[model samples]
Target: MKRISLFLLLSLLLGATVLYSQNPETNLRVVSVSPNAASLGTFGMIPTSNYVGQASLSIPVYEIDLDGKKFPITLSYHTDGTRVAQEATWVGLGWTLQAGGCVISVFGSNAKIYSANYYDIKGRVVKTVRSNLLGGYDITSTTYTF
Candidate 1:
């Protein structure tokens, strides 16, 4: 009787664990950032940045340079893709700075954002991890609904 009970308990626990980790459905989408200096060269702009993911998502980060114009950046998310995992970064300088972007991991039918960060550019002096730059914002992680 004792052996039978223990076996049953173990089996149940294993099943639950599997279901939770491999949930067939979820409503989370992750976003992320990665800065590619090559974007500058590719775009023929000396200070542009870009990020590309394994899942066909691309982000081009444009920096406001000597021209003194602040550009608006837009981001979008889609749910129909089979793979939703992504890593992104927004980077610029007069100084050096780094931060996380939105990132998502997907299971068979479920998705969750494991990490995210966003930067707001304002003011004349942007304080970064190393030095003060022309303009910058704090990096923060916020939540969203899918």
Candidate 2:
């Protein structure tokens, strides 16, 4: 009787562990790509000291499909001279940032997008590229000098 009870208990614990490991909500899906700096070059304006070199860019909102339902993903960009940061959040899942550029975060069971920064001749960022949810790229342009 003791052997049978122990076997049953061990079996139950193993089964539960397997089920927990297979849960979809805990899995992380990340999507990232290389930056295409050649395609996005400077826009003809040279940098000057008199002009304030602070600018912001806009990243489009995206929707993610999870278990036959759609959830919205939003981005927030903080622009400050050379410290331009972006934060992406999804329906209360989580948020992440990396080195004042584009980053990826956990979004339940859906995919996460990463971002990269492009700089100008003065070593200031002029453009940024982030992967969209639909296998494409989203670009944001910023003018560092006025």
Candidate that would win on TM-score: 2
Clashing pairs in 1: 31-102, 31-103, 32-88, 32-101, 32-102, 33-88, 33-89, 34-88, 34-89
lDDT of 1 by residue, 23-90 (tens): 23322354432233222222222223234322223354554444786553433222222224322324
lDDT of each residue in 1-146, candidate 2, tens digit only: 99999999999988886464342332223333222211111111322232566343334477668799876544423233221332223321121112123332222322222354433333344333332222332222222211
TM-score of each: 0.17, 0.18
List the global CA lDDT of all models. Answer: 0.34, 0.34
State, as a TM-score between 0 and 1, how close model 2 is to the true structure: 0.18
Worst 10 residues of 2 by lDDT: 35-44
Candidate 2 off by > 4 Å: 21-146
